[model samples]
Target: MDSNAMATDSTSGPTANETEQDGRVDEHNGPGKVVYEYEDPAYRVFVDTLNYLEPEEIEQVLAAYRFGEKAHQGQTRLSGEPYITHPLAVAGALAEWRMDAPAIIAALLHDVMEDTSVSKAEIAERFGKQVADLVDGLSKLDRIEFQSYQDAQAENFRKMLMAMATDLRIVLIKLADRRHNLQTMAPVRPDKRRRIAHETLEIYAPIATRLGLNNISRQLQDLSFKHIYPMRFRVLTRAVKAVRGNRRELLSKILDGIRSKLQESNIEAGVFGREKSLYSIYHKMVDKHLSFSQVLDIYGFRVIVRDVPTCYLALGALHSRYKPVPGKFKDYIAIPKANGYQSLHTTLIGPYGTPIEIQIRTQSMHHLAEEGIASHWLYKDSEESGADLQVKTHKWLQSLLELQGASGDSSEFLEHVKVDLFPDEVYVFTPKGKILALPRGATVIDFAYAVHTDIGHRCVAARIDHELIPLSAELNNGNQVEIITAPHANPNPAWLNYVKTSRARSKIRQFLKAIQQDSSSALGENMLNQELQALGVVPSEIPAAVWERVIRDSGKKSRREILTDIGLGRSLAAVFARRLVANDEVPQNEVSESKPLVIRGTEGMAVQLAPCCQPIPGDPIVGLLRNGQGLRIHTHACQATRKSRTTEPQNWINVEWEPDPDQCFDVRIRVTAKKVRGLLGRVATGISQAGANIEHVNMDGKKPGLFIDLHFLVQVSGRPHLAALMRSLRRIPDVVRIVREQE
Candidate 1:
């Protein structure tokens, strides 16, 4: 049995909670005193909240709490409370939200294994599988590691996001856990408090908002705000008090008027005046660098209704009573935020010209907005109901799990997640009248992709509200979108430079890279084919049965798969092809007589033509290896002698060109015009006429066109043969600058 529930025995090894509470008794006895209690305040509260649960659930939770209590016997928290008190408190918080049996039970055990000797299997065997999974989620990553202490914090944030993506409740439980710790944070060393506070402000608060837990979000924000900016938090708190002091009666009047208006309109609503949390106010002041007096919209009203339509009616009524601030209105009802919050938000100037923000939503939306992800658990009516809510929230929560699947690293996942978790949203409509929720500043491309990956990849154009626009055009709220897609269209590399969501970026990069690797493999295979054919074995002679046997021998996936592997330089194509070709079952003499293609340059050196000779494929060449990379092939007469070769002689190697190299090579040739008009075009024509593809040409006028070096990468034969080709260009009278890089 767990010790948190009613239990008798107190003797145990040292535990934080039980030990701290028994400190006084320990002083009388000695260190390591076994201190047991009748029942902790946290568990008492937890047991009290179990009235809504079935008798079985009550027993289950009670047993787990007691077991946890026993496991934590003699343990004390940093706050000197029984260590069981923390888990009990976490359970109490979840119970207050009216969570189901599993969650409540999980809360009771969340800290057991994380801070104690209890293992996940122990919890599973004692409680159940559901409870254990929840507990496991609340546990930190197996370990935290970093390149440096500074990076450890970043990794913590990284890990937290990764965990939250799978089970949002894990984060909620953590938040509740932190809230309790923060409440008792004074007992913790001061040095750690500020860092925790800053982390809370930056990560937890935003997540709370994303979860639609406004109440918790506000508290976490305020606590973090005070710690991160103590002076500012104090000043803002005082300023808010002063502002409310003068406007207390006016605020009452406004609240009363709103209440009265709703009543008169026959709309049931819960209306209340809300001053922004001190932390939020502090952040606003510091972040915007504004004075206390300048932050006029410090207080607002929240009007929660019973149904979705009532939310809009309430909004209309409020807008009529107060002059709305133009362009400040947002209708989240039609397009809920990424966090599943739905409402109508509008800012208005009251009779005193004070800007007041009003949020109108159904009671359910209000629940979600305030509780965020936890609202599902709190609002669940039964154990089965709680499971269903988990299913529902899981749909959203689980995406965090998949978001990281395609990401190259945790940081990539974090980037996409941060964007998706942004609190604000814009509602755009499809031409068919369906509303799609997109982040603010989302473009048509984002919308197209958000619909479906296939649609996104094939999207060529978009028509927004009957106007054709660029794919990257930012979509405005309420614009009707029509996507133009083509079956043949593929994702472009350019899309990667601007895509916002992690999904879109990952998918695009995956596709483009796959294509590139495919092409590379094809090129490598073709080169290997020519090499093999020279070995006198007909590739076709390799029967399918024999090819399969060879592939099995090589331990490769398949021929195409293997070819792609070789193209990416992952495998040696020459070696693999020889193996496959030798098993062809072809004629013996035919195989023996085939000649091997000679490749120039020593292995793993930089391949560059000797600029002095400008050697081509048909030219005799040698290989000279450079360090780190394979041998480089250069023409014999290339003027560029290696500086690294002489100094780093160990890096040098031999080189030679393939007798029949199959690929085109770029070589630069200079040409001088007779200063004739259109001479550049004619020179280009002459180069094109020489059976060589001109890669690039430069005809600059530094010496007033007296001479010009038009660098043209042209195809040619050996050094002597390329010399003859340049001699052919010299006959054109426009060839004033005739130098074949024989430097």
Candidate 2:
């Protein structure tokens, strides 16, 4: 007999009104209405679940239950029932799914630490450290204040996931807890109900699906849909009922035909019709833009046999009897899904051209499809299969750890996890014939990371089916991919635009951050050295003690960090140099004079020449020290600079052009020419002869046989080159006028 059936509550210690007999609890007639009587049904369900556990394990579960019952003795749920009933319901669900004894105990005590005064240490002392730790992982940090409700929720979720990474049981218990909560949310306020339901749909449902718990995922989705859109749920529910009535005869005929054919082939199988979940039908309607009648697969069938070989045989038998739909067959048993889902799915053309979807699987596979990772505990004696499942689950959780390390914050980590949750996978192969499954839109970079982190970091090119392709190429199913890596190659920021997987995005972001830090440090050092030279002090000659003092004063770690800040425009080098040299000790002549700002087109990212006026060599340019942005050179005639001159005069600095500019710049020009066949040709020829390349051209083609306004974006060395080009264009026969365009 299970000890849970005999255990008494520790606090109340078996009240006189309560009686325990024959492994059952009964309440006698009393002055007050008995809450225990109301809870007897749930207690019986819990007692029935103990048959799956060993005699020794049953004692441990009873201890946990007694402790939880005492901890939550006076507490009541939102439904005005004893709080013990909630935990009991969650434990019952886990038991029905055949979860391990430890998991069941953890589910019973999941809320103890958060709601009661009980400590993890006490639970650890009473029930072992494993149960205590699981309860701790499920408990949220409710007392801490957060910036917002969303922030608190995100942090709580992050903590839960981190704990889940350590032990997969934490998440399983959490799913059970959430399932029970979602099932009993009718008494909640409307706004709160919608919030909780939406979160379940978005976060928990996807997690359940990813963990291969399809039954729980589907139930969560349907429950959440009912709360989120009650009207749509009702309308769809009625419509499905109507459809079921209309299709009863057709579904019965299909089932009978499949059963008769299998029997004739001496195959014993169970054939049954499966209706699509309401949430699934609603999702299909919204995503595929289909009406209620357009969904043909609403009524499908599942065929379960004894073993894997029989599963294939059933598929063959079904295909022979009915015409199979082309390109609608998938053999998941040969290659199980990432979530360990295996089945043979095929669609057939039924009578009157109706499409009937069918799923064939073995008995064990069917169990796994419903319970997912939890199915391992159903047969606890089979340790080998349990270990195999653990290995696969560990690999997926390890990837989550990688994502967390690469992500910037908790919110970003959550977003990346969301991206990985719903996987419409496309399987591809490597050069060695090893297969990898990725999301449908996954690219070559995603494949490289799926192979290894080093390969992803150094991925420079790829070969799809032995043909060279760009990195942004989307991978197709069954394609052979070969990634080409170079030692010096690095991730490009542009790759983030197309890379689909969270792993690739996270890794690329990490690489970009490291590169930016290195570049900023180098630039900051250069700026500080230049400033020190102006102060008559060599940077290398500075004493270590003085440098340490400066670092301490600036609240920075080292000279490199300070310099990096300077280079990144986060700090001013001149201000720091003045402090380092002591303003009074510096020469007055050097302190009073301003340094001349130099402009070269090759300064790269540190100096940007504004595109508004397109400042180039020989143009009057002014440098503006925009906050956190190193020198921005703008033309004198530019309206943006003119506006800034009034609002922020101190930010403006004088800048001059280099003597011999090597880089070309774009300048726009307008040419008013007569409408003629050869006019455009002559203008283009003149500009070409002047050694200016036309980057782009726009003509006023709205009116015919009139003066045409031709705008050309031409490449030139400086203002002199542009002037010469304009002069040359004016010399054309049909050219009436020509001038440089400015903004």
Candidate 3:
């Protein structure tokens, strides 16, 4: 039997209406009532914590305990104890937080459906649908087939998150279940222990912290650290023990000094000392690359006050007594964290010049800080605080729903959720004075997405603090951002390189995928028509039956599908044309060829210029049908295409640029100039004056002389425009030679 629920050996007298059987109390039943006198000590402990609930609710909880106790009768844990102890302990942990009846009931029966003959329908029939739903959500989906362990985990997490979107309490129960399992994992094998510990550290601990359950989060972290790094944990434990003994006197002196200062200021507060958790210390050491001995500020003090205003007074009193470390003070009370955490944090030089961290907050704030969402029932005064945290959590969960809607698969959803788990945040503002909190290193595009999805999709540029900035600019703590949007603007593929938030990335990808499909369909139609025209055939002239036959023969659903395949180079346009025209009796080569396909500069992603050769509009170009990459245009003289042209002649298509393309194309040029102070400035000015824009510039200093080669990637309208810019640059005094680079 588990130690928590072992048979009692006490020598106390029995009470009335209670009888002991095999050192356990017999079940007592009455009219519309359920009771037990001296059941398993663990169940007694769990029941004692439920005094805060109504009498009827408490009876319902006891009924659940009875049901679970019977359901897990034959099951045994790795320790050879009855499995009921595990659920009992999990429920007891939640009861300590004063969770409501349904939560407690769900915690007791969370694993029954997964491990026993119990079903969700039975649970619902016994309890209410709400309780059954909570239990079902807590159960893992391992029974369903998956390709791999990772896929199963991701799908399970995705299912839980969807459940959490409906009710936040599901995760709470699940976290508690995980907590007890980790506590009793000693009997498990070493590899399994490490795997469970790693998952807890990576996913559960961060989640607990994100939900503002600081106390539970710390315990989970420490437990996971102890399992994952046993040797390191022992070393750190010994080190902390030694340090604690040595710092005893210093800690007392600091506490006395803070108490005296607060007393002198007439600030009524409770000041207490706190030690950093082992996991926190270990992470700090690893993150800052600091030795264990060099890690100071390991001990801290917290001042709990009556209200928010008194928190500031307590902070002032402490600062007046000790010199505060510069740039180490943060006032989260004014602007709470995204998790609804609020406290005044400061680091002060202690009696012996050792830094000591301090946090000052109201009593309610302290309660919410430790209990987080559980504070909704843990304390009566924390209702408002719990509601605030709930709002933030609800918003986060809603974003998960949006991510699920936009994500392609479970693994991708998991990737996006992991990206969002970090709590480090930067608070930025909009032009209208509304505040938005985003993850640290978030860019302007993330801010726009946080504002609204439509704004993000249409945003072209942004002005940070009244200065025009690119969409990729990293936002700071108090940046005032004003997004510039245009109706014609759309998300660029390059934005994916710098977008920090998953929402922005997902939205951009979704929009790009849609537009890419449309562009591909149009391009495919054009290519197919061009091929058909060469056979003296028009697509519109084809009968409905013929079109259906072609689509079905190509194993496509519709005409658009076939066209898109052709446009994406997945199917050769010539093959599709030949198939479409197979029924016709036209002789090959009997009809004169039609005009070559025209290349429009506004084809979006359907037409891509070959970057190796940098072919401009005026250059003679041919289309290379790259598999899954649409048309790749290259100059006929390009060296990269020479081998492909000979080996893969069927993939090549004749294409010509429009007479007057509206967009400029990028081309590379080399400028050999005598090294001088003003050489670059003069060349840049000449290029700008000649109506060309330099997109990139590089200098080669390999030559051991006063001359250097400057490589410029400039955008121009055509060959004539590039020549004009070259002539202008040639007039510079330090310019020795200029030649366009083509390869």
Best by lDDT: 3
The alpha-carbon root-mean-square deviation between model 3 and the true structure, to one decimal in Å, is: 6.0
Q: What is the lDDT of residue 19 in candidate 3?
A: 28
TM-score of candidate 3 versus the correct structure, residues matched by position: 0.86
Q: Give the TM-scores of the predictions, in the order they appear.
A: 0.70, 0.83, 0.86
lDDT of each: 0.66, 0.80, 0.85
Q: What are the per-residue Cα lDDT tens digits for candidate 1 across 1-743?
A: 12122222343322322322311122454332323344455445456667677665665666676677776777676555667777777778888887788877887778667666777777777777777787776665436565664455445566666666655666777778877766666665566778788767767777777666779888887777666667877776777778889988888888898898888888998888887877766668778999878888788899988877788888888777888889998776666566666678899887677788888877666666677666655664223423443564566556666665666665566566676666356678888898887777787877887788898889999999999998888877788999999999988778776666656676777676566656545544554565567666566666788778867887877787666655444555567766766652754334443343355321111234444555566655554433222234555445575565568654333434655554555566766556667777777676666666776666566666455566666765445545666766777876675765445
Worst 10 residues of 1 by lDDT: 16-25
Give lDDT: candidate 3, residue 470.
88
lDDT score, candidate 1: 0.66
**Model 2 steric clash pairs:** none
Model 3 accuracy (lDDT, Cα): 0.85
Q: Count the backbone clashes (under 3 Å) in each candidate.
A: 59, 0, 0
Residue 442 in model 3: shift from native, Å?
Answer: 2.3
lDDT of 2 by residue, 1-743 (tens): 01012122223222222333323222343222122322477776686667667655765676677777777787777677778888888899888877788889889888878777778887777778998899898888788898888888787787888889898889988887887777787777788779888888878898888887899999999999998998999999999999999988998898898899899888889998999999999999999999999998899999999888999888888888889999999989888888888899999998778898999987777877887788787655434444555677788888889888888788888888888887799999999999899999999999998898899999999999999999999999899999999998888879999988888889889887777677657656766766777777767767677777778998998888887677667888888887787634333234334445555755645567787787879988887765556667888889877778999986766668878879888888899988889877888899899999989999988956779999998899998888888888877888999977878
Better of 1 and 3 by lDDT: 3
